[model samples]
Target: MSPRPFDHVVGKNLTSVKFPVVAGLPGPEGLKTHLRGHLLRMSNVGALRVLVTGATGYIGGRLVPRLLEAGHQVRVLVRDPAKIRSVPWADGVEIARGDLTDAASLREPFRDIDVVYYLVHSMNSDGDFEEAERRSAENVASAARDAAVGRIVYLGGLHEHSDRLSTHLRSRTQVGEILIDSGVPTMVLQAGVVIGAGSASFEMIRHLTNRLPVMTTPRWVNNHIQPIAVGDVLHYLAAAATAATSESRTYDIGGPDVLRYGEMMQIYAEVAGLARRRILVLPVLTPKLAGMWIGLVTPVPLSIGRALIESLSTDAVAYEHDIDAIIAAPSGGLTPYRDAVALALRNAENTEAGWDGAAADPLPTDPAWTGEIVYTESRDAVVRADPQRVWEALLHWSSRHGHWTVENKQEPTLLELHGPGRARLQWRIESVTPARTRLHQHASYIPKGLPGQLYWLGLKPLHRIGLRRAMQSVIKESEGRR
Candidate 1:
């Protein structure tokens, strides 16, 4: 661990400066804000202007908000400014229109920027995502070198400590090399499945576990991985901007638990309070057939589904336990996969609960119910503002004082956090008009016998009523906000 550079933000040589302890702040958010101020003060004195690329992507989207909150004047490199308008702080960011493939466009974004966060990847992109990712890395590295950027922060994938790497993971490693070869100090953080809302991997797990009752288990499901929370990943990214002494080094970032995907599904089921399905695994299942099965069952696209499923055979846990030396020190304690999933679901649920009004009613309940034991929740709020304003509140509502509750097998106490309506089990959100928001309740409990099925069937109508009442409460709350 490195010393907290209380004054290093002002351009004092970090190696020589003695760090002072920071005064007490409320929490991580507060500490980040203070750090941002420190960094800005340094920038004013000619330290380094920072540039964040891939602002439109998932991790990048979350990272930008933290950066802006920290008081860093961030310039986000994006291909289309319009794609960013829906972003919460769209107006706040200094949007630089530059695609990685276009070298001419990269010059403006790299110009005079002290630190650049290289976050773009093509694994999710259409055919030849690997080649595209490599090319993009090359273009950015060349432009950054030409512009004399001091350091580059990159996030890549973690794989087994072997020469045989999955195409996806291999390209990620290559991308780091391209940036390092460009003469800039580069700190690479390699991570496995990032567990959180809107994360492709997490969502896949969520949908799969929730929708399947009896699944033809793939051998990949038995493979082990150390999953990290999205929040943790962000902390590392922020810390990496200034933590590393060696610019050309890599760090292995993972969660506290090394869990099998099968175990993960069982945890999810338990936490969500759904009945644990009996999983039957067959060793004969090939990655190709398994991927097609996933495509048939889960919402994951065929391309990524194929790539990810194939990589499961290779252990993605920490490679050399010593890689932490390069990346920034770990911030708070690591969140478990079950807890992370609960938080993510709650975040998404809370957001969904905010979309109330006439037009959004009866909101696509079955839009995508391909998962097992599907827990579909909808809530609506009718505010004086149009759909846009209601949607805004939904998207950015969680960070504030109002907390959302999600059950976790590891932490049963979280169930109490949902309040009385949630005791019934299930979530709902509805909006009759722009001015009204509704929270819906839809709960399905564990089945024990004929009595259990009868009891659940009998209560099905009541669940609908409960859902409507929950929606009503949400609407009232939204109204109170004004």
Candidate 2:
């Protein structure tokens, strides 16, 4: 770590940001108003050159855009840059090809970077994951120091110091220590279960509460937890990159409320309009059994779910709020647990990421089971005609002048319609060859409440038949055309 600690965490030589203390407004929300307003008013917007790892991940995916929004020049390092090519913000940042476990691959990405966001630590890595993470951390620490990177910001799991810490939390703590001691200033933010759409924690709670009105067993659900929203995490991360700071230390970050894991699940049900759930904790249910149960209920893979479930066995409440000294709470104080859940619910249906400032929309990489609950029926066919012909046929068949109107379009390739009471129909024209085109038609209905649920149940069979006929008609029309 740097002498007297803290590089203001951005560049070799940089002036620390100074903000006017907000007063008289009262409470935490008032205190939060100063930092953001001051930063935006700065003459130097987008001054820092930042590099981010894990660009495709849930948190990193959301943070990159915020950094860009702050007027900072951002670069991302990924093994396959193509993974992020379809993202709306893909073209806005520089891309560096690299692998974390391989030290040599990080050199170019770390070069001339003002701050390095070490956002990745994966259990999915081949062989021993602990060793893999240790190697990855060592590689990042060495590369950043060699490049004289101003600071390294890492996100770690929040847990108390104990001999009984789960393997997941222990590995995270080790990685944080390695970066802090790398002789480069580092800010390790240890956060509890992250609450957001597509986040594993949120999805785990979502499926469990949504599917099982009455859950059988895990005593871990009674453990205390202090989960934070993804938005707040991103806020602190984006701020930490440029804020005046001097510690190669760990900061515990979490939401305002401290509730039991089961209480958190019930809160989720409240926010989502679901009935209050009944949780029956069975002390005899082992972690392995709990993991298998979660696997059966949720889309999160067994490997990840197992680790997450194991960590839940310990209380995860934050030990301190020392981070407020460096970066203020996100605009309106820290997000309360209930509001965070509500925001995540809103994010579930938001196709555009961050259209709402606090919305952490689900990413393409999120499990297919995550996001808005929509009943869908789709059909596709290969027609002996060009895309234009198929598209014409698609448009003709989709037409219902009084009931449907185009929602979005992309020439002869895609057409989406919105109408007939929240139902969405879309067509895609793909050119398989000069004379052959693949036409796909999809119908999706997003149900709102009990009535919406019953509506789908009643109309599902009719929907399947109608969708099949619609695609057949389009394919026949296009194929029969000259």
Candidate 3:
């Protein structure tokens, strides 16, 4: 069979357009004509002034870079602008502070925006999240319509239409319907489990597989699901920004492979290089019971776990492939499930590395007049070595020392080293005896403002753990040297 035309190459810029030979027209001339038509359609669409909600979320955070690469003028609507300060594309795009539930805050951000990507959802919120989501969607749709926004693209869950729809899936579908009914040209791309680093579903899978070698799951494990890569989802989302489509369209999107939940776990185990896990499916475990178990084993909260577990009871395979005729398939074709898992794992590793590196970097030195010290943590250890030996150990304890705490991986900052009795900058040492040295460590931060205080309090636990680890490492190294 002939390969499909315009297969997308994964992990590259979207500029690579290919045209294959058609059956009816004459050879190269036919291909050239088709290519010209495709280019003309693309030109007619042009670049859009796009507004993205939920810019700090896993999918939205990643999507911003892709939209920027495609040369679109991007504006991000975020509740807190500081949340996106570290984002790589934060500086390149316009940012407006707004909340979807607050209709007053939405109008300014939606003004003159050609396309609005409605990515916000209240899945993790406490109490009546479904109602909250509906209200927020209503506000967004109304705001976009009032501002004359051309289109709205939404990401929703894939589920078969039925009265027994889970609350999560029901809310997703309802939000899409609300947007469509609001008279905006809305495109809803429905997907099942999104396999990507930092995605809630993928994280749950990762933790469950990594932590449990012997698993006993409910009957939902047998339900069929099609997990799509976050990359492909992003591709479709970016394409929807300009792809010609019906006024209000709903597309079910998934990866090439469909597997049962149990099969997905097995594949994840394989990709993660874990030993083959044994599974026992019991028919009696309720969603609440399963959620409690998941909450106990994984970092996911009970609310989210229950919601996700409820949705897993139904099959989520796509019923249509019409999206391919509109938006081109990924360059290298759709990512296989295993390949998607692998990519997610690689991204996770890179993210962890970045986090560790950030933790190890020196903290900003605040001037004394900034404010009063808002946070301080201290630790002390006595080493059975001379002062000189302890000093030497301190001098050499860089990030490579690997003695930092398991949680934050924080390395000490040396501010001062005077003779054998004094060392400073979060650490100080004094020789109590010729063969015994007393080491004291303290992390002190003066509040630059309210944000500084919040930052210090937020990381207090990690800071404490890091201080303890630093003192212990110094003691061990000094004692060994003696």
The number of the candidate with the highest lDDT is 2
Q: Taking the tens digit of each residue's C-alpha lDDT, what string does model 2 give over 1-482?
A: 11112333223322343222322223344323422332233323336779999988888888998989877789999999888787888889999999998999999998877789988977452468998889999999888866757678999999977888888788899999998877666899999989888888788887777667788867888999998988899988988887677557999999999999999989888987778888998999988899888888766788777888888889998898899887879777888989888888874444434423454567666657666667777777788999988888777876744476898989899998886756888888888999999888878786654456678899888878877877778888888842
Model with the higher lDDT, candidate 1 or 3: 3
lDDT of each: 0.63, 0.78, 0.72
Q: Would you list the rank order by TM-score, best first?
A: 2, 3, 1
lDDT order, best first, reads: 2, 3, 1
User: How does candidate 2 score on lDDT?
Assistant: 0.78
Query: Residue-wise lDDT of candidate 1 within 1-482, one digit each (tens)?
Result: 24222333445444443222322324444433433544454444532356999776667877776777665668889788887776557788788898898888898788767679998886563678888888899888777766656568899888887787777778888898777665555778889988765566776776667667678777778788999888888888877665636436677888888998888888877876667867889888887888788888767777677777766777788765554554444555777777777766553333232213111111112123212222333443334534444434433442231444544312211111242332324333344565544433344343322334455578777866766664444344455553
Instruction: Enumerate residue pairs that collide in model 2.
Output: 1-183, 6-246, 46-71
Query: Candidate 3 residues 1-482, lDDT tens each?
Result: 11112222222333343333323335545434433443333334456679999887667877787889888889999888987777667789999999988999998999877789988876664788888899999999878766656678999999987888888899999999998876556899999998866667776787677667898999999999999998899899989887765357689999999999999999988986677878899999987799889989766777778888988989999989888888889899998999888876653222112322221111112112111223556677777888778767776664444433223222332323221111123556678888987887765554332344466679778867866776777788888942
Q: How many clashes (backbone N, Cα, C below 3 Å) per candidate?
A: 40, 3, 5
Clashing pairs in 3: 8-330, 8-331, 8-332, 9-331, 9-332
Highest TM-score among the candidates is held by which one? Answer: 2
For candidate 3, what is the TM-score? 0.68
Query: Model 2, stretches more than 4 Å misplaced?
Result: 1-46, 347-358, 380-441, 446-462, 466-482
C-alpha-based local distance difference test score of model 3: 0.72
